[model samples]
Target: ESGVGKELVAKNIHNSSDRAEGPFIPINCGAIPETMLETELFGHEKGSFTGAYAKKLGLLEIASNGTLFLDEISELSQRLQGKLLRVIETESFFRVGGLREIKVDVRFVAATNRDIKKDVETGEFRPDLYYRIGALTLRIPPLRERREDIPLLVDHIIQSKPEFKHKKLSGKAMEILTNYAWPGNVRELQNVIYRALFLSSGSTIEPHDLSPDLTSGLTVSGRRLEDIEKDHILKVFREVNGQKRKAAEILGVDPKTLYRKLHRYGIDD
Candidate 1:
């Protein structure tokens, strides 16, 4: 759920809406410290606080006439939740340490991986805020549930990387990706693709190019586990310009072990 492309969905919504011409602002509620998050949302006047050297506009004002995406909204503290609820209701808020209330016309898009209903029941999140934001809910399924989309997502990711423009996934490699349980979702898949591209010998990404964790105990191209290990060792060795110590560090093995493996694979140097 963490890497299920929630922000992408929010962007799609904003781009297709009437407010497409306006700024699309996004902030992760969980990432910012509580003290600073308030100022970030409401802005501050010059000399409003110790660091207030110049007037500043907050995300609320910046996203006026547009969309404000609040990622991980459930992480907001109770105080901020109350303030946000007030903003949704009144459509006006004062900047930090400013007396004049500022009005904003902003459409809010909120997302969270947590079970917000449970959180609200447990008194962690405010119910009033939840009701306002939950009017229209869109649930994105995990990668494993929608395995068919992996190929399309993979292609999209590949096309985005300039170096991977000429690279393509082998049929067996694609099968392994689609079948693997992607607990980390699209993020993990992207990382795997990048890793595979770095380790792959040719234009095609084969099953052996994938991280060992993903292909463990799985045979493809009728290659034995030892052969897979040999191929991986040789690839790492070459990628590091035959620097055994660096290759060993990358492979998480000692230099002596890598040397022994190289010898066993009948590879000199």
Candidate 2:
């Protein structure tokens, strides 16, 4: 789900909106440590803490009149979630250890790879905050589900990179890419293409240029356990058109086991 390009979608929304002229700021909540995340989002005032040298502006202020993309927002702790909910409800927040409340007109776009609703139900996420951000939701399917977009995406990636300007994917290579179960989604495809570009001797990328794990079916000696299982299950699931029972039968596993695995892998249906 991560490599599905949620941030890209968020940036597109921001660019297409009235705030296109304004700055589009992005932050990964899960990437930053919890201790620093609060300061990063709300900033700090001079003398607020040991390292607070000057009045620092938070993303909330910097993204004023624009969009603040909160990627992996589900990773926010409950305390941070409450603080964020308050700001969302009031459109204002105070700088860390500051007396004055700073206000900003910011469009929030949140993304997560987890089932946030389930998180809320399980009490891991706040329900009120969920409703606030859930006013609109968009689901981007994994690459394997929408194989039609592979060629276009491949072309886009190729054209975007100057080094690969004259390079092209061979028909067989494209076929292998189109049929393979992309467990890593678009990000993986991008990496594979980039690797092929570098390893390719000529202007064309061939099937053999792809990584062995991606091309070879005879061996799984070097592949990660989860990756192999994910690929096999996804292949069977797709073959059965997402019929869990049939897939379970083919996989020699129970329907519930198959369902649990699919859910764990973030596969829809």
Candidate 3:
């Protein structure tokens, strides 16, 4: 889901909009550590803390006259969520320790891979913030669902990379790529192609050059929704060792729902 190029879509929108020439700052919310996420977004002043040797500007400042793309936004903590809401409401924020508030004109574009419907319902994500960020939403389709675009995408990748420019995919390899489920979507495809090119000296790529996972679909790939859900619930239960609050938070389910599921699955305390 991450490799699905959400930022690419956001860039496309910005490039087509009035902010075409302005900077586009993209931040992956899930990649940053939870403890430092706030400071990363709303930078600190010099001597703000032990490591504050010099004052620094945050992403918001960097994208002041441009677009601020927040990827994996669902990973933000509730405290940061409230802070972010305040920034959105005021269009201004203070440096981590400085008293002065800095204002900016920025177009915010947030993306998430989570099940928003479930997250909002479970109270894991703030509904007010959700409405604010999702005022304009666009969903990108996964690669497997767009089989017709494989050839064009492959061509684009091949031509884009210098090492891959001279190489071509064999008919069988291309067919396999086009038909594969592509669990990792376009990003995975790019990786496979790059790997295949790196490993082979020949001008054409073959099926063996690609990852086996692509050719031999896993048995779990065809499982029914209910079976998958059961497996996931069990996995989460085991991961948290039956800690209801933690499990519910991770599963994006309320406590009562988690309790009912525990009873349904007969999971002991």
Q: Write the per-residue lDDT of candidate 3 for residues 191-265, one digit (tens) a residue.
A: 888888887778989888887786675423633466567768889988988788998999999989988877776
In order, the Cα lDDT scores of the candidates are 0.90, 0.90, 0.85
Q: Write the per-residue lDDT of candidate 1 for residues 1-269, one digit (tens) a residue.
A: 88988999999999999999999999999999997999899999999999989888999999999999999999999999999999999999999989998888999999999999999999999998999999999999998789889999999889988977899999989978877778788998999998988899899999889998788853253344685798788888789899888999999988888888889889865
Q: Model 3: runs farther than 4 Å from truth?
A: 217-269
Between candidates 1 and 3, name the one with more favorable lDDT: 1
Q: Model 2: number of clashes?
A: 0
Q: What is the C-alpha local distance difference test score of candidate 1?
A: 0.90
Candidate 2 clashes between residue pairs 3 or more apart in a chain or in different chains: none
Candidate 1, residue 108: the lDDT equals: 97
**lDDT score of residue 240 within candidate 1:** 85
- State the lDDT at 23 in candidate 3: 91
lDDT of 2 by residue, 62-106 (tens): 999999999999999999999999999999999999899988799
After superposition, which runs of candidate 2 have C-alpha atoms over 4 Å from their true positions?
Answer: 218-269
lDDT of 3 at 187: 92
Each candidate's clash count: 0, 0, 0
- In model 2, where is the ten-residue run with the lowest total lDDT? 218-227
